[model samples]
Structures are given as structure tokens and as C-alpha cells.
Target chain A: MSEAPAVRLVEVHKAYRRGAQRVPVLAGITFDIAAGEFLALMGPSGSGKSTLLNLIAGIDQADSGDVIVAGENLARLPERLLADWRATHVGFIFQFYNLMPVLTAYENVQLPLLLTDLPRRERRAHVEHALSLVGLADRMSHYPNELSGGQQQRVAIARALITDPPLIVADEPTGDLDRESAADVLHMMQALNRELGKTIIMVTHDQRAADHAHSIMRLDKGVLWSNPDDAAAVQPAGQG
Target chain B: MRAVPLAYSLRNLWTRRLTTVLTAGGMALVVFVFAAVLMLDQGLKDTLVATGAVDNAVLIRRGSGTEIQSGIERAQIGIVEAQPQVALGAGGTALASREVVVLIGLAKRGAPDSVANVVVRGVGAVGLSLRPQLRITEGREFRPGSDEIIVAHNIRRRFEGADLGQTLSFGGRSWRIVGLFDAGGSGFDSEVWGDADQFMQAFRRNGYSALVVKLNDPEAFDAFLLGIESDPRLTVEAKREPVFYADQSQAMSTFLTVLGLALSIIFSVGAVIGAMITMYAAVAARVGEIGTLRALGFRAGGVLLAFLLESLLLSLVGAAVGLAAASLLQTYTVSTMNFQSFSELAFGFRLTTAIVLKTLAFSLVMGLAGGLLPALRAARMNIVEALRAA
Candidate 1:
């Protein structure tokens, strides 16, 4: 059985403007992500992995080509509409957890839901549910500074899932955690993909963290290469 | 996102307490100066507003701004009294009197070496009875027919030799001060009263300075004014007491308004600059945090609005502090040169609701102005670069 891709990038190109210089970051990259699939993107520094993730997540614009995430062409959307699309359809997890230092873990989980028209009682229930999903219901009132690195990452994951977006894009989710903590986070991500049927696209340099994904895609010098048959395979050419 | 903004910004400010305090202090000083200027304007206006009494009308020479320069002929007094608009006294005579106003210098009591200006008025025998509001708060009223004088409550406290039985030399005549009186905190509270005939004879003045006419009805001011001005025979101007007092305050009031606006603008600019610097520092310190927010799907406009709200919140705190301190100034009397009266007039700080509201509103504007550019800079930051910095 096969599932349709949740995200499809067709010959996408991204460039940066630095004092009249159009320095290219990603050039003619193409990729697809299936629904409920766990995908890992492996790349060296400056290989455009983060840029590609930003483009797919609708956080940044692509200079050219179609970025269809959940069947919506993000590149053609205006900033306001793009923001609305992101709010409803995408969830992002950062390497540092990025929890607001002033807010408790529960409030951090509640952040994305504030953009919705949910009633206060309903929003609270959603946040509580998200926190419980991360196994952090007891630490809901704890601030980011008061929590450990692994706990903070859990809170971030909870925040990413708060809006129940169809797609979750995690940028080095385990980059700042210890080995055991990283394994715990990897387990949580696997559970989210398997049990909740969430389609996740994660970027990580650690092979051990990438080992949990069902598929591995590699980008080299702005180009993407992927395996056709193996459950998890990295193309040697792109890896280099 | 709405809840995140306030939560994040407030926590950030709390984390950076030292910087926030310094920024608040700078804004507070600016607001203090702004509030003081407004109070000065209000104080000057209130001082003159208090001078008008309901039953009185001030008759001056046509085209003159003050009683000091006004000259009404002695012959016109009979015709003015004969006008049906004049109120009748107990003896069936018109209740009107001629008076002279002049500025005099007196040595201040506490600052004995410093000279200050005081208004000395010459009134008819019926003048004391005309102003029934006047009361001798200390010492006796001056003997009506003598060269003795009665000093206003405020004048006696500020100047030397102004208490009962003390002597004051004015226009080559030394008069004894036998009374200390008050006239309900009006401009009359800043003057000294003496017999008009004796005062004019000693000062070598042939004509009265102005006439104080008690009208039959307060609303008859226009008719009385027309009767006095439109007649070719009498070259005089007549106005209701309240209207005349308002005009008399014009110069000082204008000065205060100009000073208040100038000070508020100057201070607000400084406050805006301080707020800008503070917000810029905040943006710089939170580069990574802001990037995280962007990466979490917050649009640039949301980030910009959040910072602007933070700045406005800080400025409002400062504004509240400044306004509270300024309100305490109601009892603080300051000696200033009244341009219209050409005297060192004493007025207390006046805190009006309108001025307070305007000052706070200006502070809010300052916050928005100062926060806009820095917030824009923060919003425009590249997500990748910010993440890399983190």
C-alpha cells in the first residue's frame, strides 16, 4: 500500500540578496513527503537543508518553482495568506526548543492555538492535552529555564503538535540533548508518527537520530537524492 | 500568538530588569518636566479666573487692555451712575465707584534683600462696602478716611512692613498698613487698598484709573457696554467682571501655553530617543528568541506589534509616576513674573484633568514612535541567521 505525499517540491530554487548579489542557496531541488511518513534530511553545513525545510514549511519564500505542502502552493501565496496557511497546516520544532522563557510549558503549548478562534476553555483543554501527550502534564507550570534540556525539547514538540497540523517539520530536534534524552525524544517522535499518524520531516546531522525515520533523503550542493526501495537509505552521491 | 506576545515580552522585560529600570527612569524625568509645564499653564489660568465676582463690571478707557493705563474722567462718573443699569444702594444712590491701580515694589519678608511687585489700589469710601466678599482675616480694616491701608492676605505674607501697623512708602507718601484682609483667593488677594482721594492727591494723579460699577443685573453687561462704548460723549469701555478678568490673564496664559508645549515637545523627543535605544537593545538581546518566534510561524507584523506594545507599557508606567508626583504640586507656590500685571505674582501648581490626560496620551505616542523602527528591524531579521546566532 502507498500513501500520497503530504509535501511536494518541484524544482524549487532559493536565493539570498546580499548588497545586489543574488547568492543561490538551493537550486532546482525536488522532493516529496508521504502522509504519515517519517522522513529525515541529512546534509553537510551550507548544503541548503534548513533553507529547504523553511521553504517547505512556508516560513521563507522560494525564488522559483512550486512548493506544494498538503496540496497548497505556498510559493504563490501572499505573506498574510501564507501565515494563515502555516497556522492551520504546519507545525515547526526548532533545535533549541525555543520556548518563551516567560511562559510555563503549558502556555508555550498554548501559543499556536491563540491564533485560532477557539474559546478560552477549549484552548485550555487543547493545551492540556498537548502537554499530556508529551508526558509533561506534571511540569506544565514549569518555565523553560526550570526544565532540563530533554524536558524543554518535549515542550517544544508539544507546541509543534498543539495546532494538530497535518505536517510537522523539526529542525535538529535532538541537536542539544544528551544521548539518553535524544533516544527518548526519538521514541516520542516514532510514537507520534506510528500512533497519531503524523507526517514528519526532520533535519538532523546525527545518524542515530536519523535511524528512527522510515526514509532518509540527502541534499548535496542544493540538489536532492533519495533511495527508491529501501525503507531508509541515503544516496552516497548526495551524502558526499 | 496573542497570548504568547504579552507573556514573552513581559518575561523578557522582567529578565532584563536593570535595562528596563534605566529606560523607565529616563522616560519618567521627561514626563515630570512635561507635567510641570502643564501645571504652570493651569495655575496661571486659575489665578486670573478667581478674580471675577458676579455683581461687578470693570469700566476702562476704550481700547485699553489694563486698568493701570485706563483713564475715566471724573465728570463721566455722574453720568455713568445715572444710567438705569447701575444698581441702587441703601441711600438711593448708584452703587458705582472709581479706583486707581498701580504696581509698587516691596521688600519680601523671608528674602528681605529681594524686591517684589505688589498691586496697590486707591478706592472710594464706598469701595470697602462694594466688595462685601473682602474680610479682615488678621488685624483691623484701615480707617476709611485716613491715609492708612489694608493689605491682601497674600501680599502681607510675602512682603515686609505689610502687617498691621507696619509702614509702606509709595509715590512719595508713607502710609501705615492697619489691616490684613482676603478676597476669596482672587487677584485682589495680591493687592493693597487705600482711600482713592488721598492716594491720588499723594501720587499727583488727576483722574481715576478705572471704575468698578455694580450692575442691576449681571446679564445687562452687553447693554451697559454698548451704552458706554457706542456713545460718542463717553470714551470708555465696559465689560462684565468675568470677561475683563479673562482678558487680563491672556498674556500670562499665552506664555504658559507656549512654555508647556515647548517643554512637552522637547522632553517627549528625549523620551522617544531613550525608548528607541532601550527597544533596540531589547531587539539585539533577543535576536535568537525572535528568530524562534518567526520559525514558530509568527509573522513579522506580530513580532513588531509585540515589541511596540512592550514599549508602550513601559512608557505608561513612567507617565503614571510623573503624573502622580505632579499632582502633589497643588500646594507648591512659585513666584513668577506676571507679564500682564508686570508684577511678581505668586501662583500654586494647578493639576487639571485635561492636562493629565494629554500628558499621558503624549507618552503613549512617544512609545509608539520610539518602538516602531527597532521593532521593524527585529521583524526583518533572517530566520537562518538568527538561528545560527543562537
Candidate 2:
């Protein structure tokens, strides 16, 4: 609690264009994610939970207001610098795993390291370390399609962790898995948070999936409720 | 920034083997034609230029662009030989030859009905000394003042009645072929040679086409040229033989080069279009991949460079294949009509370092031109929107 938060957002807003019409997605949002804390963002469909995660990951820019990640003001940073900042500071996990089908699991995990100035031998050691952490070290040469859904997600998680970034933002980390596979992914993510002490902010629609996090925040109709206790936990308040 | 690993692009092309081969094949065809055209142009120029001896000078009538159109009287020949710059032979005779060039119709050996113009040069033993590259391959030289001619070794294959010991009639006289000579693939290899005085009497001509003379000193060409041009008694022009042959080849070579380039330019458009369509499809299919790459911190410039390199690899593969195919033509020869002399000229495709470099530059341009827009689109894609697409 004494340390500065790993992520801070000041009145963040974003919108989309629906055929020349402005459709608001996130409106005036503010939040802070403490270092080494696992935070989950819960929202109904079309609630802009994924967009908020994108803003935190620096993959998309906010329409208005400031987004600060790992002590860097992202909204003020130009796009050219943001990519370098993201490479050094944050990692991204997607809903479908998004592993390149053409690359082996080892190659997919090595993609981020390719942007670094590390020597090839050092990169190989780092890639092996990350892949082992995900327990897919033996599947290093298998492509995405050749692995099961849970295994593919593990490969993607290995890719996200390969750069050893302090912050990890995962969008629907278990969305494409079956119940068993989803449990496996959730358990691995919890281990990543508790054992490795990573700061994680994940977007999910399933409360059971959100329960793995130490803290839960909710979004609805472009608004944020920072405390899960503010509304009854069993009610599923924002379900469409 | 470090280059994206070549293996990445190589693997992508391999993953889409069908499109890769099709696009690269199209590029290869264009580059093939481009290289072949350059080779043809070089070959024609080389053959013509080889006929000229650097230390020798050629004299033609003023305003006559070629020897075929020039005329020098006996008095003019005597005046040119008397110049001190003219080299003396072993017997103290001036190393100069009064030559007459005339074109005679000859039937092609394969297609007897198809006729081509062949040059017939009337020369003496002095003319033989002027061009040391000329060698009698078979039989003997034509005797002076006799109805005798010698066919060039190459000319004998293409024309009728051009073999050793054969007879041909033209210009109100019949001349027997006494020998066959080789001119080391020079333009002279396409001509027939006989006695100049006998040729003049047979054709009823009073003037020679040109006077070819060797310089007494290597650097005496300037004096030789000045002596001929400064003479008030003669209205004639003289030039070093290399310059003369180069001038003769300029117009025909230029026309061929321009025509070949225009065709290649037109062909390259279709090739570039094929590459564009393939690259656009690649971008479309890899939308999710591109988004992931952007999310992984590859700058837009990096993405653009990666795609451009992919396209360039495809085109270069094609160019290599095309150049290999073009080099095969270097072994065989083709005959074309030299517009300067109105005679058939035989030459082989000649590959030079300059042509190779030019073809490579040309293929790279096609790749850059084709891949640029598609690469821009890939670079500019919104990461959120791209990742959102299925």
C-alpha cells in the first residue's frame, strides 16, 4: 500500500464511430491497480470492459483524459514512444490465445524477445524459462492448432511473460475454453499472480472466473463500480 | 532497427506456396524479357564494334554517314596514302586499302524464297593486312584481277552459292568463291570480299566506298584525321575505325533498346498488379497477426518494412530465375538486319555486369511499387479493430 500504484487512470474516456455517429464506449473512468495485486474487471456485454483493458495495455488510446501505466503517462506519450514503453512495461493476453498459427509454441513465445537487444543465447534461455513456467516446455515445437485450448492459452501466457514485463492485461483469458480448460487457465493465472507477484488486470464476463483475482471491479453501461461489495455479489447485477 | 528475421518472410511465403509461386512467376517472366533485351542490345553493339581496329582510321565522303553511302575517287585514295601519318608495311607500301561496299540480295539457306541483303566488300592483300583478325579458314584468297571472291565463314552458312568453290553472279559479272574466312565474330564475318579494281570494272563504278588506313604511330590518329580533313583538294571525313563502327551501330541499337524497354515496361505492369493483389490478400488474411504484432510493440515502420521485405524476396526470387533463363541465350546466335548497312548481322546474346545490375534494380522497383500500398494499410491498421476482427 505504501508503493505507488502500478496503473492509474484519470477520467479516461473512449468512443467508437458507428457509420459517422459517435457511439460512446467508456465515459469518464478512473481507477488505480496496486503493484503485485490481481484485479479483475467484470462487465456485461457491450460494457467496454475489453476497451478499458486495451487502454491499460497501451494498445489503444483514450479519447480524453489521462492513462498512466507503470509511472509513465501514456495519454501524453506519442504513439512512436508508446510501443517502446509497452515492450518494456506491459504484456497482453487475448481471448482466443492469438498464437501465430505458422509458428511453433517456442517461436510464438520468442516473438516479443525479437524486439529486444538481448543476445540470441540469452533470448533462448529466457524463452525456455517462460515456456517452462507455463508447463508447456515439452510442447515447444507444437503449433497453436496442434495444442488443446488450455495448452494454447498456456503458450500465449508464456509469450506474455517472455518479456518479463511488470504489468499483464488479459482480455477474456478463459473465454474460448471448456469448463475444465477454463479452470486450468484460471489456476495458472492465479499462480502467475501469487507466485511470480505480477500485477494483473483481467476483463471477464464470468464472475466465477473473476473470483480468482484478489479484488474485483465492475463496469456497466460505460460506468465503473470500483468495489464489488457496493452491489450484492450473488445478484449478477449487470448481466444483460 | 534490426531487420525482421528473413525466416519470417520465408516461412510466410512457403505457407502460401500457391500465391508465392504465381506472383513470383509473373515477376520472373517480366525480368526474363528485360534481361534478354539488354543482352540482345549488348550483343549487337559488341559485334559491330569488334569489326573496328583502334589504330586504323576510316575515310568517307563528306556527309556520308556510312561506308555504303560514301565515295572516294582513285585520286583521293592516292592523296590519303601519301599522308605521312599513314603507316608503311614491311615492303614499304602504305598500309591502306581502297574498299568498295555493295549490298547484294541473297536467298536464305532454309527458306529459299526469303531474301536478305549481304554486304560484298572489294579489297586487296593490303586490306588483309589492315585487319589481322581476319583469317582464311579454308581454300585460298581470290587472285587479283580475276573473277574470284571469298565468302566469310559465317556468311557461307546463311546464303546460297556462298560455299568455297561455289559460283555466284551479280553486278553484271560472275565471281567464283575461292575461300572462306572468319572475322572472329566481327561484322566483317557477314560480308564477301573480292578484288577492288575487278569489282569496280564489273560494277562499272569509278569511285571507292571508303579508304581504311593504319596509323604509323598509335597516337598519330589525330594527325591522320587532320591531314584528311584539312586537305583543300578533298571533301572527305576520316575517323578512328572504332568510332566509325560505334556510330554505325548507334541507331539500330537504340531502336532495339527502346522497343525492348517499352515492351518490358508494359509487361511489368501486369506483374506488379499480380504482386499487389497477392500482398493485399496476405494483409487481409493476416489481420489478426498484424494486430498481435502491433500489440507486441512492433512500430508501424517495422510492420511496413517486414511486408515490403516479404514482397521484395518474392520479386528477387523471380529475378534470379529470369536471369538464369536469360543466360541460356548466350550460347546461341540470332541474325537481325542492321538498318545502318541494310545487311544481315549475326550476333549472340551478350550478358554484361551492367545488365545484371539493371535487371535487379528493375525487379526491386516492381516489388516496392506493388507492395507499398498494401504495406501501408497493414501498418496503419488500428490494433483494437484488427484484433476484434475474427
Candidate 3:
């Protein structure tokens, strides 16, 4: 692992405006994740975990403070440049899998590579290899609607990894899956982190899902606790 | 920056097949009206323009706009026939046709109670030879100095008592139809033809209505026109036959063009609105998909282009459908009163490559007008809010 952290948040804060009302989601907080570390973020609904993940993934801007991922300060990057930065530096996995319904598994996995100047033959080879990594070599031609929830999530995983981005941000990746499917997706994610040496940040409310990560962090009411024991003590009841 | 794949837009339209078809159908109806109108105008212009040969010149009274309203004295015809520019026919005679054009009211074929004016043209001996396109398609040619006549194919099909072997009561006489001739889809197809002397005796006309003369060299038309017009003894003007016929069609063609354009404008408004609604619905339905694309590093411009492309494809489909339907109109003939000549002229729709290009450009404009706002909305969506929508 590199000595420098893969993701660093310096007193980051975020809030959204609903009509005339301002709703703060993330308070000014600082944190870092070492290169190649697999970290899980757990919180109740509306605890800003997803917001933090989104900020780290460069999909959302911080209202104040700096968010540095893969050594680039996201708050300083222009909107157009941020998209390009995300394309080559960050991968995202969403709760519902977010595969284009019209595309087959292979096409969905190959979507990100369309941004590159890669030859068509090379793109095909890369897409096949990514689908294979997710153990979906035979299912490449199946659409999202035709696949099980687990298989769709695997397709999403392949999509996120296709560009070989340094950092992966997954938001409740297994939330919509059955128990077996959830386990299967979690195992694949773990394999990606361990075997490929990918830096991962996952947001989930399920403690078992969080346990698969190397360490866990919890957010509550726009505040974060890095200590696992302290986080468990302050954890709200009935929040998985 | 990379664009959203064209396949993405295509597949999305296919996925919403019902919406796509309904929107495209509306556009198709508008394009049909637009294309049909242009074709009607083109058909009218083509029929009249094709009536006169480039080498032929028509001489009528100084201010007469059409042959029906003109009178050429016998002395004037004799002078025109003697011109050196006139072409020599068989037996070394100048190819000049002293024609009489008159209108007779006839009952329409299917509507017996409705009557329309038809042109009855009396031509000299060499008149059929002057118009090379005129061919006897059925029955034999009318004998000279007889009451027999040859009805044009269009006239024969459209009017009662115009068929071969039938007799038409007109000009205080009953004229027998001895032949059916096809004028190759020219304006002459709307006229009945017979011997000029016979028609003059029956109609009690003292002079010819017009004189059609074939020029020895088509390129010498300017000199020939100047000589005829400058003659103090002749109160007549000369026009290239094609130009004269083209002028005859101007009023009716303009009327058709205006009417067609007005209808297309009115119908296109509805189609544009239909397209806008369809695009808006598509944007609403794919809010999550748009956000997913944005999150996957696709720029706002790419999303906008994708939606625009989808709308263009829908309109292109509609244009094709409308053009196909309009092209079928060429197979059938229609008759309408020419405002200039006040005679019923039959013509069929004519489609050209220019019309196809115009239809496509029109449909694409409709698509762009309808799709722009919705596409902008999709492209400008907040990524976080859109992701939450999923």
C-alpha cells in the first residue's frame, strides 16, 4: 500500500436546500482512508452516509472544506473536469444496481470504456474479462430484467471495475438482494478489494454487510465516529 | 468528451415502442399533408410546362394571357407563316398551326348534374405534327374538314360523350369523336381537338384564336419574337410555347402552394406539441437512467445529445411514412379548374428528390423544436437528486 491516503476529507460539510429550508446532511468533519483499505460506513436513514459517499465519489460537491480522492482535491475541480476525473479515477456501485435496462450485461459492463479511445476489439476483450471476473461469463448476453438481483449487482461491479479506477464507492450495494444474493455480491466485492488491491468505501446500515470491510465507521445526525466501539455504543436502536 | 452511444438512444426508443409509434404517427400525418401539397403544385407546373415544345412559339393578341382569350386574324397568320424563321414541313410548307381555342360546358363523368368547362381546340392540318408528343392511343385520327374530333386521354376519361365513337353536342353542332389521343401528360390532354376550318364554320368564328409555329432554329427565338412584335401590321406578341404554358399555370400553382403550406403549418403545430409531450414523458420516465448515465461520467451535453438523437430518429420514421403515402398519389389522377384558363385540367401528383429532401428537413425541424427543452432539462438535472429518484 502507498504511504499517502487514497481518500482524505478535510472538515467537509454538505447541506441541501428544500424549497426555502436548508437541511444539513454532513457536518464539518475530517477523515482519511489508507490506500487499498476497505472501509464501511454505517448509519440510520438520513445520517449523511450516502452524502459522504457521494462527495467522496465526486458526484456531489461539498458546501465547505476540501475532499481529496486519488490525490486530486474534488472541491477545486471544475464540473466538466470532475466528470472526466471520475471516469478515470473513481467507480460507483449503487443499491439498485443501476444497470441500463436496455443494455445486456456485457454492454452495461462496457459502457464506461466507450469514453476511452480504445479499439472496438480491445473493448470487447476488456468487457469479456470484466464479466468473467464477476463469474458472469455465460450471462453476458442477458439483460438486467432477465437476471437475478445478485447477477445484476455483479454486472454493476464489473462495470465499476471496467475502467480500472483507483477508488470504488458502493452505496448499499446488496440492499435490494436476497440473503444468498447479498452474500454472493459481498463475496465478489471482497475478492475485488483483496485480489485486485482496490480502495473501497461502502455505505450500508446492515452490520453484517459492514463486517466484510477491513474497518467500520458510523455517522449519526451529521456526525461521524471512527472508533468502532464508540460507534456501536452510540448506534441508534433498530437501525440494523 | 465522449458522446452517448447512438445505440443507447435507439434502444430507448424501441423500449418505449408505443410512445414512439404514436408520436411518429402524428408527425407522419403532418408530413403527408406537407408533401402532398408540394406534389400537387409540382404536378400542376409539370403538366403545363410540358404542354409546349421548346422549338414552338405561340402568337396571340398583344394583351391576351391565354389562347382562349386571344384572336389572331387570318392576314396576321399568313404573315407569320411566311417568316423565314418558321420551320418547313412536308411539301415545303411552313409548320404553322392556326388554332381556335374555345370552352364548352360538359357533364363530369361521375357527377352528371355538375358541369365543368372543357377546352375545345381546333387545329390546322399540321397541328398534330407540330406537337410530336401527341399520339393516337386508340381509334384512328380525325379526317380533315370533317366534324370528327380526337379527344385527349384525360378529357375522354373525365367528361361525358368524350369517348371514341361518341358524339358531343357543342358550338351549335354535334362533333363525332373519331380517336383518343394521349398528350404525354401535358396540358393539351385537357382539350378536345378537331379541324380548325370545321370548328370555325360551326362556331361562326371569323379568325383564329392563336397561331402555333415551329421555329427553324430554337436558338433564333429572340430575333423571331422581335420581328413579330415590332411589325406595325401585326397586333400580336410572340412567346416561347413552354414559357406561355408555364405562365398559364402560375396562378393555380401559387394557390395550391399557399393552401398546402397553410394546412401543413396548422397540422405541424399539433405534431410538434405531440412530439414535445412524448419527449417530456420520456425524460420523466428515464430520470434515473439519466442520472445513472451522468454518474457513469457521461457529461450533460452527452445526455442532451442522446435525447435529441432519439427525437430525430422518431421524426425520421414519421417522414418516411408520410413520404411513402404521398408517393402513392402519383398513381391516381385528379382534375381541378385552372383559374387562369377557367378550364378543367387533370394532373397527377409528382414526387421529386427535392420534395423528399424538403420533407426530411421539415420533420427534423419539428423534432428539434420539440426535443430541445426536454433534453436541456434532462441534461441540467441535479445528479444527487436524480440518483435518489432511482
Candidate 4:
């Protein structure tokens, strides 16, 4: 694990336009996750956890302040460069698996590598290793619809790991999965962080899901708290 | 930037097989109409152009545009045939045919009540020799000054009282149909031939319609044409035989081309709209897929190209189908009134390589027009909003 943080947010702020209204999602957010840390963000609905994760992944821009990920300030990069930067630095996992229904498991995993200059034979080898790491080596030819939800998420994990990116951001990765499937996915994610020393940031509302990470942060009304009890102290009784 | 694979576009189109087929079918129908029109125009021009030999010169009245409207007196025919450039035949006679062209109304083979105008050509002794491609397909040639007529192969099958051994009552006289001659798909295949003197007397005509002269050297045509037009005693003009026949088809060919193209334009609009609708639907259905692709680091240009490629492939499939159907039209012959000659001319549809290239290019244009807007819409979608569509 490195002493320097893998991701740093310096007073980052973000907002969305709803007609003429400027609705702020995240305000004055500042945080850091060490190189080998597994941090989970817990928040209520509409609390900007996903927005913060998007900022760190370089998929969205900050309205003000800076978002630095993988030693580069993401807020300063242009959209074209940001996409390329994401391809090399950040892997994303969505709640719904987000696998292309038309492509098989191997092809879905091989999608990111297509952006690189990797040869076909080498791409096949990387895809094979990634799918095997997720324990779906035999299901490489199966499409998303043919696989169970847990299996599909495993395929997405293989896709995320195919490029061997430094940081992985998952937004409610196990939100749609059953208990057993969620446990399996969380265990896989933990192994990726511990064994490969990769930085991981997860956004989830479930405390049990957040428990898999090294530390947890709670967000409420565009503000962050290191302790869940500190955030709960400000909430009215029975409001959650 | 890495482009989406061609297989991806192909597979996506295959996934929506019904929409792809329906859209492509519309484009194919438009292509069929476009190609068929070109073939009809080519067929009309080819039939008339094949009627005359390039080495032969045709002499008609100075102001006449067609043989049917031309009048050349017997004295003028002799003066025109006596030119030094006229080719010599076997017995040292000038190779010229003083022909009388007249139109006669005859009943069609199946409908006796339906009468159509048919051309009757009275050729001199060397007329058959001049047209080397003319072959007596069924019987022998007509005897001179015997009221015996040789019906063209196309004329015999199309008109009544024009078959072999049949007698046609016209020109206040009975004429015997002695033979059926095929003119190798030339305009001559629509005319009946008899001796010039007998036709002149039977039709009460004082002069010939035109004089066809074979030149000794085809290269001497320019000087020969100059001499004939400059002659003070002659009221005739000379043109290369092939040029004369080709001019005969110009008006009718232009009419068919204009009409066919107008129809194709109207139909292509509908097909292009159909393709647009199909592509729009594809984009709407695949919004989530597009977002996922973007998230995987594909540029907007890649997404746009993929959709456009799918549309182009669909249109090409339609073009191939339409062209196959249009090619079959080559086997059947059609007859219509020639605007220039005012007589029914039979010609089959002719397909050429130029027409194939034109049709494919036209289909590609329709594809590009229909695919552009939808592809732009797909490419311009907001990534976060698009992912939420899933």
C-alpha cells in the first residue's frame, strides 16, 4: 500500500439544473482514500453518494473545487481526455450489471481492451484470465440473459478487471442481487482490493454491504461525516 | 479512435430482423423502379440504333426528321445514287435502295377490333443485301413485281393477316405474305418489306420516302454529306444511317426516361422515410446499449458510424433484391407507340452495367439521408441520462 492517497477531493461541489432551478447535490466535499483502501459511502436517497463516486471516476465534472484521481486532477481534464483517462485508471460496476445483452461473457469482458492497441490473441488471453478470476471461465460464451444476476455481475467484474485499472468504483453493485449473490460479489471485490492492492470506492445505502469495506462514510443533505453516529445525531427521530 | 466492429452493426440489424426486412424491402422497390426505367430507355435507343449500318448513308427530304415524313422523287433518288462515293455491288450497280415507307392500319393478332398503325417499307433489289443481318427465318424472300411481301418476324406475330401464307388486303390490292424475316432485333423487325415499284403503284405514291446508300469508304461520309447538301438540283439531306435511326429514338427515349425518373423520385422519398423511421426506432430501443458503450470508452463518432453502417447495409440488401427482380424484365418484350414515328415499336428491356452502378449509388444515397439524423441523435445523448434509460 502506498502512503499517498489514490483519490483526493478538495472542496468539490456539484449541482444539476432542474428547469430554472439549480439543485445542488454535493457541496464542499473533501476526502481521501489511501492506495490500498476499500472505502464505502453510505447515504440516503438523493444524498449525492453516486455523484461523488462519479466525480472520483472522472465520469462527471465538479461545479467548483478539484477532484484528483490517480495523481491527475480530473476536474481540469477535457471530456475526450477524461474518457481515455478513465479507460486506463478507473473501472466502473453498475447496479444492474450493465452487460451488453448481445455480447457473450468473454466479449463483454473484452470490451475495454478494444480501446487499447492489444492484439487479438493477447486480448483473448486477458479476457480469459479476467473471467477466470471471477470464477466464470466456463461461462465465457453465455450471454447476459442466459446467466443469473449474480453470474452477470461476476461478468461485469471481469469486464472491470480486464484492463487492470488502479481504481474501481461500484455504485450499488449488489443492490439488485439476492443475499447470497451480494455476499459473493462483495467477497470478490474485497479480494481484488486486498490481493491486488487496488483502491475501491463503493456507494451503497445498505449498512451490511458497506461493512465489507475498510471504512465507511455517511452523507446527508450534501454534507459528509466520518462516523455514522455523528450523522445520525443531526437527523430527527424516525425521519430515516 | 477505435470504431465499432462491422459485425456489431450486422448483428444488431439481424436482431431486429422484421424491421430490417421491411425497411430494406421499401428501398428495394424504389431501386427496382429506378433500374427498370433506365432499362426501358436503353432498350428503345438500342433497337433503333441497331436498325442501320454505320457505313451506310440515308437521304431524306431536307426538313424531314423521320423516314415516314420524308419524300424523295424518283429523279432525285437517281441523282443521289449516282454520287462518286456510292459503293459498287456485284454487277457494278450502285449499292443504293430507294425505299417507300408508308403506315397501314392493321388489326392486332388477339384483338381484331384493336387496330394499330404498322410500317410498310418498299425496298429495291439491293435492300436485303444492304442489311446483312436480316435473315429469312421461316421462308424464302419475296419475288420482285409479284405483289409478294415478306413480313418481319415481330410484325407477323403481332398483326393479323401478316403471318406466313396469309394475305393482307391493303392499298386497294391483295398482298401475299411470302416470308418471315428477323432483323436481329433492329427497328426493321417491325416493318413489312415488298418491291418498291409495286408498292408505289399500289399506294398511288409518285415518289420514294427515303434513299439508303452504302458508302465505298465510311471515312468519306463528311465529304459525301457536304456534296449532297450543296447540290443545287437536290432537295435532300444526308446522314449516317446509324445516326438517322438513333435520332429517330431520341424523342421517345427522353419521354420514357423523364417519366421513369419522376416516378422513382416520388417512390424514393417514401423509402427514405421508411428507413429513417426504422433507424429512429433502433436508436430509441438501444439507448441503454449506447450509454454502456460510451462508458466503456467508445467515442460519440464510433456510435454514430455504427448506426449509419447498419442503415447502409440494410439499403444494400434491398438493392440486390430489387436488381434481381429488374433483371428478369429483360426476358419479356414490350411494344408502345414511338412518339417520333407514330408507330408501335417492339423492344425488350436492356440492362447494362451503367444501370447497376446507378441503382446502387441511388440506394446508398437514400441510406445516408435516412440514417444521418438518427445517428446524430444517438451520438449527442447525455451519458448519465442515457444510462438511466436502462
| Two-chain DockQ for each candidate model | 0.55, 0.66, 0.73, 0.50
Which has the better lDDT: candidate 3, or candidate 4?
3
Using TM-score as the yardstick, the better of models 3 and 4 is 3
Judged by TM-score relative to the true structure, which candidate is superior, 1 or 3?
3
Query: Residues B1-390, candidate 4, lDDT per residue (tens digit)?
Result: 777777778978888899999999999999999999999999988898899898999999989988889899888888888888999898889999989998888899999999988899999999999999799988799998889999998888888878899999879999998899999999988989999889999999898999999999999899898889888999998999989999999998889999999999999999999999999999999898888787778888888998999889989999999999999999989988888889889998999999999999999999999999999998888777787787
List the candidate numbers ranked by DockQ, top first. 3, 2, 1, 4
Which candidate wins on lDDT?
3
Q: Give TM-scores of the second chain, every candidate.
A: 0.92, 0.97, 0.97, 0.97
Comparing candidate 1 with candidate 3, which one achieves the higher DockQ? 3
The whole-model C-alpha lDDT of candidate 4 against the native structure comes to: 0.89
Candidate that scores best on DockQ: 3
Q: Which stretches of candidate 3 lie over 4 Å from their true place?
A: A228-240
**Candidate 1: which stretches are off by over 4 Å?**
A1-3, A17-23, A227-231, A234-240, B1-4, B125-133
lDDT agreement of model 1 with the native = 0.83
Here, model 1's chain A TM-score works out at 0.93
Give the per-residue lDDT of model 3 (tens digit) for B1-390: 789888889999999999999999999999999999999999988998999999999999989888888988899889998888999987999999999999999998998999999999999999999999899999988899999999998887888878889999998999899999999999999999999999999889999999999999999899898889778999998999989999999999889999899999999999999999999999999899899999999999999999999999999999999999999999978899999899999998999999999999999999998899999999999998899999
lDDT of 2 by residue, B284-322 (tens): 999998898888888888888989988999899889999
**TM-score for chain A of every candidate model?**
0.93, 0.92, 0.93, 0.94
Every candidate's fraction of true contacts kept comes to 0.43, 0.67, 0.70, 0.28
CAPRI rating of model 4 = medium
| Full ranking by lDDT | 3, 4, 2, 1
In candidate 1, what are the lDDT values of residues B1-390, reduced to their tens digit? 343457777777778888778787777777888888888777766766677766788888888778877778888877777787889888898887789888888899888889987888988767877777688887787776688999987887888888788889998989998888888756677889998888888878888888888998988877887787777788777877767877887888887778777877887788889899999988887888887777666788888888988898878878888888888888887777777768767777888889889888877888888889999998889876877667
lDDT of 1 by residue, A1-240 (tens): 666679888878888889999878888877667799898998898888999888888878888888999889998998768777888888888888887788899888888887889998999999898889889999999999999999999999899889889999999999999999999899999998999889999999998888899889877788777656546774432111
Worst 10 residues of 2 chain B by lDDT: B1-10
RMSD of 1: 2.7
